[model samples]
Target: MMENKPDEPVDHLSQLPVLRLNLHELAREQRTEQGQLALRDLTRLLSALVAGHAAVQTGQVDWRVRGYTHAQPGGDVQPMIELKVSAVLPLLCQRCLQPALQRVQDKVLFRLVEQEPGLTQEELEAEDEALCVRVAVDIQAMVEDQMLLALPLVPMHEVCPQPIVVAGLEAQPIDLPARASPFAALASLKKGK
Candidate 1:
């Protein structure tokens, strides 16, 4: 961490500005933007992190976004945005219940669309791991959303620092009587006849 004197002026260049990008304009002009953000500025993501963990101790985020259009076979141009983000997040390990540092990375290609008949664009995000968006885009919120999704379902270290024992009943193998085959019932009926 860089320390500044009380009298020193702060440099704001490293700080990212809030952006609400117009997806349509971006695709038409094929624009690209890249910058770094303070994790403290990302309220939602910051709240998700484990408090007082060294992994996310620095509190930083890196992001890049590019927009372009693709001409479909029918001469319809489709707006698209390619987004990439990466960050080291602190999370509670499910295995040992300890603070685990997890690197979350996400590269997504979003097909921008207008309103669909019945489907919500947010709901379409989970389809086949692809992303879709409509209207203007809030870059900050988008980054948070993608980052959250990229987080591991169960965060854990490959090898825990130490083993942890919990009080629980040991699982024992169960044996059950096998059920007769469907044909056995038919055989029984025929024999009775």
Candidate 2:
């Protein structure tokens, strides 16, 4: 049996777990934050997101996200969250079909819209990064979405492990026994009749 120490005390804050946050509330309060997270926690979420992707390797990379939520400029009262995500992941090179390291870095600034907008041209063209935060936001999911979007359209090694070679079919002629044409048979039957 070991003796209990009275002098030392545990610091719980440092060991506290990170939880999903309400982006709207954070924005309302106007705060700046930063944190580091492991890929292990997001295995299932990422598996579904990257199912068809060649580089579906998971649990090797770590993510770092930094952001600040504040009122948008130009006298806009609405809040905007600007976030940056950085990570390095192992991806399959399309050229060689082998594993290669890929660096993913993305930044997004979103102006939180309270109500879902009706069908409009601006909503159609809102690809520049704007999201409506009506409920608590899952930071992990948000970062994963950014990572998935940042994946290269065509992932390839700058210098492939092996060179790709394409072979063309060579033209060749096949020999076959000659057969009477249908018209010849028809004429023969007509003559026989």
lDDT of 2 by residue, 36-104 (tens): 555545554355333444344344334443334554578667666777777666667778877776787
Off by over 4 Å in 1: 1-16, 120-136, 167-193
Tell me which residue pairs clash in candidate 1.
none
The global Cα lDDT (0 to 1) of model 1 is 0.77
Residue lDDT tens for model 1, 77-155 = 8787888999888888889988888888888887776654346677566432334455577888888888877888899
TM-scores, each model vs. reference = 0.67, 0.60
Model 2, position 136: C-alpha lDDT score = 74
Identify the runs in model 2 with alpha carbons over 4 angstroms from their true place: 1-18, 44-76, 126-128, 165-193
**What do the candidate models score in CA lDDT, each in turn?**
0.77, 0.65
**TM accuracy, model 2:** 0.60
Q: Which numbered prediction scores highest in TM-score against the true structure?
A: 1
Lowest-scoring 10 consecutive residues by lDDT in candidate 2?
57-66
